[model samples]
Target: MGAGPVYGQEVVLTAEVDLAEIVRSKYDFDVAGHYSRPGIFQLTVDESPRSVVARKA
Candidate 1:
């Protein structure tokens, strides 16, 4: 939890794999991975890659 304020992200993706690239380049994680299954994923990023793509979107 937060002592005062905190920002968090939780991603459950079924498609839109393009967003996955943005996330892969942005956040630094200690330990992370995926299942062999194709579309199932858990992902997020803190660097706000959306800002990089916002103008295009």
Candidate 2:
């Protein structure tokens, strides 16, 4: 599960379980635990939102 164009400096993807790792490894993003969600991970790339969105899965 994922959504957003959070309008920040990084491309942030909210993915759960195996999906999180897949996104991170596939895209070379860094994976971190979501602040408020269990079993969910945040994959982040330090880049413009528009640029990252273009690389969507």
**Per-prediction TM-score to the true structure, in the order listed:** 0.16, 0.18
- lDDT tens digits by residue: candidate 1, 1-57: 223333486544353346676777655542444443346755566775465355644
- Tell me the lDDT of model 1 at 4: 30
Give the clashing pairs for model 2.
Answer: none
Q: How many clashes show up in model 2?
A: 0
Residue 36's lDDT in candidate 1: 33
The C-alpha local distance difference test score for the whole of candidate 1 amounts to 0.50
Candidate maximizing TM-score: 2
